[model samples]
Target chain A: MKLKDILFVAITAVLFGIVYLGAVYMGAALTGILTPMGLGIYGYEPFYGIWFLAAVFTTYVLQKPGVGIIAEMLAALLEVLMGNFFGPIIFISGFIQGLGSEIGFAVFRYKKYSLQSTMLAATGCTVLSFIWTGIRSQYWTLSPMVVLGIFVIRLASALIICGFGCKLLADGLAKAGVLKGYALGLGQMTLEEE
Target chain B: MEKLNPFLKGVSILVCGLILSFSYSVLLNGGIIAVSLILLLFFSKARLTSLVKILVPAFVAAVSIFFTGMMFTSGSAIAPEAVSKVESLNFEVMSYSMTSVYNAIQLSSRILAFAGLGVLFAMTTDGEEFVKSLMHQCRLKPKYAYGVLAAFHLLPCIREEFAKAQMAFRVRGIPVTPFSMKPVFAMLVNTVHWSEHVAMAMESKGFDGEGARTYYTVTVIRWYDWCFLAVTVSLLVSGTFLLPF
Candidate 1:
């Protein structure tokens, strides 16, 4: 990666680290509120998308092979530095999720930035995270149907948030002319054309 | 503990944490938590006060995750026979289930162990050393490693700049909520600009991003690292998987 790109990833990771912290705090609270009602993992559906946006947006902006993993892992490292209770697990989680989200761009061999590619990343995250969290969170204890329901909800969250949400944010930046020099920025392959 | 390579410490923590997370034996989890806490308290650099600082919040997180885990209602998660023996108690606005409560205790205790592993790693490992090890042991390119290293050193400066930017916004009468997009836009624009400038400046200073570079510091894994690795891996393997479930 270019030095500029590397530094940009670092800055983006730090900024998103703050966002992750807030989202996690809120997600935990929602879990607390919803658990009594037997809503289970479904309560956390909204927050799942926010977790992978850093990876998605960074990959979208840089269009590099490993920027997604690096950005996501760095964000998790920042979370550790910021004193998140989950500590090293956050980094582990970031590694898995980022790799999963990178599938969208990777499937096209980093060439395609289409909406379809982005949605694939979300669906990828949903499937990967389902297996990953199932073991850790003991989701197997829940009925198969409920586990399946939670997985579906997570997929929608990833689709809407990482896929569409990141698309909008990047485009908003692109249209404002801030992402001028970047590869997939507004000057090249504008979202309108896509 | 102090003698172990930073990278080695990271790997050890990660290995044990994975082992702990992979299984659902509440007894093993609790045992690991108890032993790790004692080892960290005595042998690691962490003080009791700091351990408590991380643990208290972890406790809260564990409680939340535990209850959430219980609501899964899987047939095998908790015995179907225990469902009827369940009772409910409402604390005015909140309700609880006896079976759910039992599962919550198991899950929460595991979370506590999970959190404790993190604390052990963070408390013992120095961030800079870990970064340096990444460069030497992991063979991370100078461009990325130094880029991140510089970013780590410049964190305080970044905070200052962000604060200054917020103050400027306040003075300019711009409405800024924490979740607002405008601020995020501004931050990204500035970060990109700064990254470009710094990259150019470093290149001009003869800091090439490519080719082989000699390291000023070395992070050789010592005997203690080997011992630590053996002890942790064996303990995790035997304790988590070998025990009868």
Candidate 2:
């Protein structure tokens, strides 16, 4: 990867790290509020997609082979350094989720930055990370219905936020002319010219 | 513990977490929580108040998980009828068996153990040292490490920009929520703008990401770091097998 690619990934990680930390607090608060309703598990579920944002967002903007993994891992590292409550396990989680996002783009051979590709990346992130959640959170202990509920919510959140949300954000940035040198920017330029 | 190599410390904590995942023994999980706490307090010099701050959310999360586990556990000991009754909220008092309760405790305690390990690493290790250690000990490329470090330092700038954007929005009478994307988009524009300048400036300053470079601070992998790693792994492995509950 070029120096700029590395820098962009790191920057994205740091930027989203702040947002992820906020989401963590939000998840905790929501979990607390929902505990009495027997729905605490679902509290974090809604925001799970936010965790995959760095990976999906980076991959979409960079259109690279491994930027998704690197960005997500870097974001997790930043979270740890920022004193995230979940700690080091998040690093492994980042790797799993990043791989999921990458698989989405890899399916199209990194040629297409279409909505379908980002959604697939988001789906990949949700499914792969769900297994990790199952192991770490012992989701198997929960009733299948509850586990299914969590999965569906998380998948939807990933699809909406990480999938379409990232594409939208990138398009907005590109429109504003800030994405001038990046692959996404060049792609947009070509489309405009054609 | 604070003096240990950051990479080894992270690996040890991660390994211990992985080991804890393979079983549902409460004793092993409790041991991890205790050891991590003790290391944090006495060895790592983490203050009591700060530890409490770190733990309050964890305690809340654990409690929530515990309750959720108790109410919805799919333990085989519980009859399918009881599991089905949970959805209706009309279960008899006998629906919750001892097995479900045990599963709940196991799940909650494991959460605590993972949190403890995370806290131990986050509190003890300095971010810069960890990144430097990654470069010195882990042989991470300077390009990535330095880029990460540079971005890490610019976090305050990002925060400031966020606040500025939020204020700018408010001044224009635009309604904004914390979750609003407008300010976030504004922040991204500036981030993308700054990235180019930052990369160019680094290049101008003789920053060669792929080239060999000397380090001002070197993190050594000492015998005790290995000792810490070995002792941690052994204790966790032995605990997993020997612990009854």
Q: Which lDDT tens digits does candidate 1 get at residues B195-239?
A: 777778888888988987777887787888878888988888888
Q: Per-residue lDDT for B69 in model 2?
A: 84
Q: DockQ each candidate and list the results.
A: 0.47, 0.74
- Standalone chain B TM-score for every prediction: 0.84, 0.90
- For candidate 2 chain B, the 10 contiguous residues with the lowest summed lDDT are B85-94
In model 1, the runs with Cα more than 4 Å from the true position are: A35-45, A81-83, A89-91, A144-146, A186-194, B69-71, B78-102
TM-score of chain A of 1: 0.89
What docking class should model 2 receive?
medium
The residue pairs found clashing in candidate 2 are none
* Candidate 1 vs. true structure, TM-score: 0.86
**All candidates: CA RMSD in angstroms?**
4.6, 3.3
